[model samples]
Target chain A: MTGRDRSGGTRAWGLTVAVLAALAAMWPLLPDYNQITLARVMVFAIFAIGYNILFGYTGLLSLGHALFFAAGLYAAGLGARDGGLTAVPAFLAGILAGAGLAAGVGALALRTAGVAFMIVTLMFAQAGYLALLYFNEWTRGDEGFNLPAASRTVLGLELAGADMRYGTALALFALATLIATWLARSPLGRVMVAVRENEARAAMLGYDTGRVKLAAVTISGAFSGAAGAAYGLIDGYAGATFASVQYSILPLLWVLVGGAGTVLGPLVGAVFMFYLIDLTSGLTDAYMLVAGAVLVLVTLFAPRGIMGEVRRRVARWLP
Target chain B: MDFGPHLMLAAIEGAVAAAVLALTALGLSLVFGVMRVVNVAHGEFFMLGAVLAWAVAHLVPGPAWAGYLAALVLAPLLVGLLAAAADWVVLKRVQYDPERTIVATIGLLYILQQATLMAYGPEARPVAAPFDARIALPWPEWGPEGLVLTWPWGLGTTAWKLVVIAAAALLVALVFVLVQRSRAGLVMRATQFDRETAQAFGIPVARVFALTFALGAALAAIGGVLVVPIQQAHYLMGGDPLLLSFIVVIIGGLGSLRGTVVAAILIGMSDGIVSVFFSPTLAKILATLLVAFVLIFRPQGLYGTRAA
Candidate 1:
C-alpha cells in the first residue's frame, strides 16, 4: 500500500517475461490451425492493450477505436497492394496514418467529455466505415481485398506462411506488451491516471489535462494501428469489417473481461473471449447472445475482471 | 430552377422520415433527460416493436385492418414492458452510472438483436398496410408554350405514408402535452431537475425513472410499428435508427425534447433531400460529419443548458 511497497514495475516486468516465455514455448507446440487462432488472439491482445491506454488508464471510453485500427489495416494493405512497398514501410505507414488520424480526431473529440466524447468518437468511426464502404473502387468495398504475399516480406521474413505469421504476431505482441507496461509506469502515465481520476484536480495541479489526454489518444491509436496492420498481414486480407462498430466494441469487451488498467489484463481478456466465441461458434448461431450475457455478467458481478479478481485474492503471493 | 416536382417529392419523403425520427429520437432524449443514462439498446426496442407487430399481425386470426390495429396498439406496449423489465433487472443493478449503462445497454442491444434473429430468422418481413390507397401528387410544369399542372406518373405517395406522418405528429404532440401539462409530467420534470429533492418530496424518483425509460422505449416501438408497413421488420434494422437517433439527440442537445424534434426534422429533411439529389451514403456521411462539428463547437448541444 505504501509507495516503496508498490512494486508495480518489478511485477509488470516479471509478468511480461513469464508471458513471452510461455508464448514462445507454445508457438511450436500449437497445431497449424490453433496457431492461426493463437496468432489472431495475439493480434487482438495488442489491440486491447492499446485500447486500455485510453479507456483503462485515462478513463476515456471511446466507442470508435476500430476507425484507427481500420485505418492502419487499409494503409498497410494498400501500400502492398498499390504503393509497391515492403512490409516494414507499409506497417509504418499504417501506424503513422492511424496515429495522425487519431491525433486530429482526438483534438476535436477531447473537447467534449464523458458521453459526448463517446458519441463524437462513434460518429467519426461510423463516417470512416461509411467512407470505406462507399469508396469501393479503392477499398474493394465489402468484397474484401487480398494482401499479396510478395509485399508481406518484412526484413526477409515472409509473413505468408503460418509459422512465420505466428512468429511475427508473437513478436509484435511481446513488443506491444513491453511498451505498454513501460508507459504505464512512466511519469506521463501518472499524469494520465491523475487526469482520469480527477481532471479538474489534475488541471488545478498545473497538468495540461487536454494535452495529456491527446497524447494518450495518439499513442493508443498508433499501437492499435500497428496491431491492425499485423492483423491484415497475418490474415493476408483487408476489408470494411475492420472498421465496423462491432469491431470497435471487441477491444473494450476484452479489456473489461480481463481487467482494465492492468498491464496483462487485456491479454487474458483477449484469449478468454477469442476462445469463448471460437468454441461456441460451432454449437449455435447465438454466440452473440452468449457474449452479450457474459458482458452484462462481467459488468455486474466482475467489474474488476478475471485478472483483477485473481490479483485481489493472491495479492501478497503474486506481487 | 425547374426541379419543382422533384423537390416536392423530396419534401414528402422528408416529412415521412422526420415523423418516424421524431418519435424514435424523442424516446432517446427523454431517457437521457430523466435518468442521465444513454440507452444504447433503444434501437433494439424499436426493432422489437417492428418484429412484434409482424408477429401480432400474423398470429391474430382476424381481418387485416383489425389485426393491424391490434398490433399498432399492442406491440409498443409489449416492448415497453420488456424494456421496463430490463431496466429493473439490469440497469437498476448498475445503479445507472452513465458509462456502465452505455455498456449494459450495448449488451442488451446484442441480446435483443440476436434473440430476434434466432426467433424471427434472418429474413425481412413486411406488414400489409391497413388500407391500400395512393394519392397522386400534382406539380406545375413549365413547357415550351406555357406553365401547366400535371400529375407525375410515379410521384404519388401511399395513403399509409401520409397517415403515418399524421399519426406520428399527433403522437409527438400528445407526448409533449403529457410531459408539459399532466401531473405525471410535473413529477418527471421535478425528478429530472433534481433527483434527491424529488425523492424527498415523495415523487418516487425510482418509479419515475423506470416509467420514463419504458415510455421512451414505447415511443420508439411505436415509431417502429408505424414504419414497419413501409420498411419491413428485420433483425439488423436497429443499427441505422440507433445511429440516426443518437445523431438527432446529440445535435438537439441531450434530453431536450424540443431540441430533439427540431434536430430530427432538420436531419431527416436533409437526409431525404440529399438522398434524392445525390446518394444515401453521402447523406449519412454528411450527417455524421455534422455531429463531429457540433461536439467540437457546442458540446452542450444546440438547446441544452450548461450543467450545474
Candidate 2:
C-alpha cells in the first residue's frame, strides 16, 4: 500500500527479451524430454498469462475460462480438420472464438461478483464441457480429435516436426508475454488495476468498471483461446480433456506459482509446475498429490505467489 | 413400456436421485449459510465416504449387511473429523476470506482426489446392499372391471432404494430438528446471522465454524454411504454429484435450507422425466443454464426470499 506501482520505468522490455532469449537458447542444449516439457510449458504459460490479465490485473477470478479456451481449440481444430483452413487461419479463428466467447460469458457472469461470479462461470464451463460430450459425433468428446500433420503445416513447413513445433510454441508464448507486458504498462491496464482494487472509487472517478472487466475478460479469453489453438498445432490434437474443470484450474495454478500479475511469472510458474508434475509422475501415479500439496502450501505461505513475493522484497520495479 | 409406466419409472428413479441430492445440497446450503464459505471439496468428502465404506465393508469378516452397517456408521463420522481438521488447518489460517477460501478448498479438492486415487485404485467398485429385495410395482388401470391392478415388467425397484429415500427423509428431519429446535442450532444460527456479534456475545465462532464444516462433510458422507450400494465408488464419480449439488444450492437460492431441499427434489425428480423426453446431457446443460439465468435475473430463487 505504501510504494504503489508506478509504470514506465523498470526496463521491463529488456527483462522480457532476456527471458525469451534464455528460453530459446536453452532449447538447443536440452534433451528431447526437457524440450517437449518446455514446449508444453510454453503452451500453459500462454494460458496463465491470459488468465493473469483478468485475475491479476482486472481482479476477476473465473472458474470457466476453459469454455473460452475450448471455444478456440475446437474452432481451430475443426476448421483445420473439416473447414480445410490452413493452420494460421485456424489459429486466428481460435483467437476470435476465444475473445468472442469470453465477451459472451463475461457479459452475463459479471452481473454477479465474488463467489457468485465463480459459480456462474463454473456452471457455464461445465455446460460447455457437457455440450462437447453431447456432440461427440463431431467433437469426439473426452477422447478428442486430432489435426493431421498436413493440416498443421504453415506454407509447406510441417509443424509436426519438433523444431518447428517448439519454435512456433515459443513464438506464440513470446507474443503472449509481450501482450501481457504492454497491457500491464498501459493506461487501460491501470484502469483494470483500479477496478480490481476499488471498483467503487474507480466508478466514482467516472470509470466504467463493468466495461473494464468485460474488456479484460475478452482479451484474456483471446489469449487462452490462442493458447488452446497453439496446443492443437504443437500437440497435433485437441481433446475435450482440455476443456474440463482441470484445464481451468491449471492456468490458475501456473499463474499463482510463477507470480500472478508479473509478465514473466506465468512462464516461470508453468515451467515449475510442469516439472513438478513430470518429476513426481515418474516416481508415482499420484502426481497430483504433490501438486495439490504444493498448491495448499503456496496458498498458505505465499499468498502473493512467487513473483508477487519477489516484487515485494527484492525488486519494487517488477512491473 | 407404455407412457404411464415409463413416466412412473422415471419418477421413481428421479425420486431416488432426489433423495441423495437433497441431503448433499442441504449440507452445502448449511455450510454456505453458516460459514459463508463454499467447500469445493465437498464432493471429495462424499467420495471418501463411499471409498471408506467399501474398505470397511471388505475388512469386516461378516455378512454384507454387517459391513454395510459398520460403513454406514463409520464413514460419515471419519469424514466429518477429517473435514474439521481441514477447516482448522487451512480455512482457519486464511481467516475464511471468500476468495482465498475458494483457492484453498480447490487445493483441498485436489489433495483428496489424488489421495483417493492413490488409496482406492481407479476402479468403480460397488458395495453390497444390506437388503435388496426387488419389489415389483403394480399400476392401476381401467379394464373390463372398474379398476384392475397390472404388474409392470421392469417397473420394479429394490427395497434398498426405498430405504435410501426413507433414511434421507429421516436425516433431513433430524437436521431440521437440530437447526431449528436445539440449543446448538441456536448457536449456529447466531453465528450465521452475525459472526462478529456472536463472537462478542461469548459464542465460540471459530469452533462453530469447524463444527459446521464437519457437519456438512458428514452429511455428504452419509449420502455417499447410502448411494454406494446403488452406484459404485470411484474417485471420478464425485464430479457429477458436486456439480449437481452446487447447482441445487444456487438455484435453491443460496443458503436457504428449505429452498435447497425443494430445489433438489424438483431438479432430481424432474431429471429422469426430462431425460426421458430429452438426452440426460441435454438436461444437464439446461439445468446449468437454468441456474445461471436464475442468478442473473432472479437472484432470489423460486422459493427463496433471500437474494443471492
Q: Which runs in model 1 stand beyond 4 Å of their true positions?
A: A1-8, A316-319, B134-157
Worst 10 residues of 2 chain A by lDDT: A1-10
Q: Write the per-residue lDDT of candidate 1 for residues B1-308, one digit (tens) a residue.
A: 24775676677788899999999999999999989999999999999989999999998997777888999999999998998899999999999999999988888898999889899999999998776544332222322222223334433344577788989999999999999999999999999999999999899887898899999999999999999988999999999889999889889887789999999999999899999999898899889989888877886678888520
The TM-score of candidate 1 is 0.95
CA displacement after TM-score superposition, residue B157 of candidate 1 (Å): 4.5
The DockQ score of candidate 2 comes to: 0.71
**Can you write out model 2's per-residue Cα lDDT over B117-136, one digit (the tens) per residue?**
98888899989888544442
Per DockQ, the best of the predicted structures is 2
Q: Candidate 2: give its CA RMSD in angstroms.
A: 2.7
* Candidate 2: stretches off by over 4 Å: A1-10, B134-156
User: lDDT by residue for model 1 over A63-143, one digit each (tens)?
Assistant: 999999998999999998999877888889889988999999999998888888888899999999999988888999778
Model 1: colliding residue pairs = none
TM-scores for every candidate against the unseen true structure: 0.95, 0.95
TM-score of chain A of 1: 0.96
Report lDDT (Cα) of residue A113, candidate 2: 88
